[model samples]
Target: MNLDFPTVMLIAAVITGMIWALDAWLWAPARREVAARKTASGGVSKADLKELNKEPVLVEYARSFFPIIIIVLVLRSFLVEPFRIPSGSMIPTLMVGDFILVNKFVYGIRLPVINKKIIDMGKPQRGDVAVFRYPKDPSVDYIKRVVGLPGDRIGYFNKTIYVNGKPVPQEIIGPYFQDEHPLSQSAELRIERLGNGEHQIVVEPGASLVEGQYIVPEGHYFMMGDNRDRSNDSRFWGVVPEENLVGKAFMVWMSWQWDQGGVIWDRIGESIQ
Candidate 1:
């Protein structure tokens, strides 16, 4: 089974809080009164009473960690959440081992795990880099740029993108090169400008994905990786449901170089477009 740390933290917080609340509201007060009565009646020894009312080890640990766990849960569920990039689908924009902070409430405030948005905060726009629960397998999380909004016709052919029968502007910048790539050695790079959001993308000369024309379904968003030739995204699967939306990736707090030593300090603290 996949170990979901967020869910574990939430469960721990609830269990610990429950035990502590019960003690504070009912059990602790009753125990203190019983102990006092016993002492007055000379029925129980002081040492015995103290030991009897002592908390269990599990409860003690829980009480110590409950506050921290709840704080994290609340912050991640409603405000922001941290995620580590594990793949190179979002190359140039995001890298493997990149620790990014996603704005949780940008799209909307959703219940964690179930991911049902209760608030109508805002809608996603074109060129937004969004993290979401993968439509093919909701258990997995995927990150991609929003290419097509609801009701727009999206098409990918001849290594170019089209929306609503109009071609999305692209300007070739030449071959993409990196010291050490997590996915590929090299690819052609370009700048794609969709409205005010302009971002870099890379495509292989003879490479192709599940490229085809698709009419974006209502309440769904078409997603694509910056590494166009290699991405396994909406092109291969399907549109991401609005309910599956997680958050918009806003910044990179840290980036690590696994093949080499230490961090890629330059990429750290960079704003994600």
Candidate 2:
């Protein structure tokens, strides 16, 4: 089953908070009053009074966990959230097993679970590494570089990108090869300048890929993976709606190489472009 984590957390926080409040407002007071009456009548020992005032195990647990759950929910929903890169779609920029921090409020502030935007803070900019719900499947989160904003024309032809009839500048940085990554060894590393910033992109020479001009609709964005040909992006599916945006990925807090079975220490603390 596709578990909705945000919804689960919200539910847990509500249940725990209610239980704690109810116990304090109703149950605990009733217990103390009964204990006081018993002691005044000399019908209860100290041990009996203590037992009567004791809280239920469920209430105690609720009190302990309520604070923690509420904090996590608030931070994750409005501030920042951690995400694990699960695919090589963003390869060189964001590797598989890389744990990244996404700035939740960069694009806007949205409510938890339902993700309804309540405040406008900023908009996604071109060249930003973004995490968003997949247009084809909203249940899954996909990370990609913002290649085209709303109403912008994006073109991909022969491993090169064209923005508004102008070929985007690309400087070949020579061949890219990872000792443990056999599939990426043949790809060419290049610096592609998009918008006002530049980031590295990997493209296979002579590799056939989906090439065409795409016009981004209003309130939608075109996204592309840095791993050019290997990524499933707007070229294949469609533009990501503004509501599907999750956050802007800003840093790689941890990286684990599954194939090598070791931590990639160098990638840790690396800032995402």
Candidate 3:
């Protein structure tokens, strides 16, 4: 219902690849042989023979593109898949154009179209960045930092985060640059320490608390964006169910900013922390 562009592209690639394979292995070869025999006996004109030759053009293109599509689909559904940041939700850590790679099998390997989990690999760890289907709208994908696991109590007040009744430490680092949003014109860069992991985050002083305490239900997790002031995550829409878990975001493979034309080489190979 709420199918996004990526899902549609993947489906298209699969359908096209199947058609191509069928033609090559079953139909096209037979048709070609028939045409060849007709040509040898002078039963068909040159123009008709030319048209017959073009019958395999679609198959050829499909065969060529099948490998590329399969590679992407396998990587995206079972290994590591790349994604681009579209909003300021993960600002300090991931910019609007920052491209990231998510480890698809970290949680489990699921079939792409059906999204049915076929294996149990790992569970979400505290302080990990993750991608998942929006609980309210399954077709929409979202990325966020995992803060609370199942049965964990997460609290947010006065712009600070508290997990399991303990306060998470945050230290001011420096001023953050504003890009794509006017509200970020004067933001503070801060390092937030969660459990044993530390990550950079952006905060706006004197900003109101957008979310409050929540008890993460079983089989669900609480998530938040690094850009505390901008993300609409579990705090607003509710926890992400275990079934919605897609993958753990692990690295930035590439970045493309319309303002900056070609590849953003500097951001490449940067690990997701």
Q: Assess every candidate by TM-score.
A: 0.90, 0.97, 0.82
TM-score leader: 2
Q: Write the per-residue lDDT of candidate 3 for residues 1-273, one digit (tens) a residue.
A: 566545776886978888887997878888898889888888798889878767566777787787888777777778887788888799778877888888989898898878889999989999999999899988778999999999999999867899988889999988887544446556888999986699999888757658579999999999999989888988888899999998998889888777667677888998989
Q: Show where candidate 1 strays beyond 4 Å.
A: 1-3, 41-54, 182-186
Clashing pairs in 3: none
TM-score of 1: 0.90
Pairs that clash in candidate 1: none
Cα misplacement distance, residue 244 of candidate 2 (Å): 0.3
Q: How would the candidate models be sorted by lDDT, starting from the highest?
A: 2, 1, 3
Candidate 2 local lDDT, residue 33? 95
Against the reference, the lDDT scores of all candidates come to: 0.86, 0.92, 0.85
Better of 1 and 2 by lDDT: 2
| lDDT score for candidate 1 against the true structure | 0.86
Q: What is the lDDT for 189 in model 2? A: 90
CA displacement after TM-score superposition, residue 131 of candidate 2 (Å): 0.4
Candidate 3 has its poorest 10 consecutive residues by lDDT at 177-186
Off by over 4 Å in 2: none
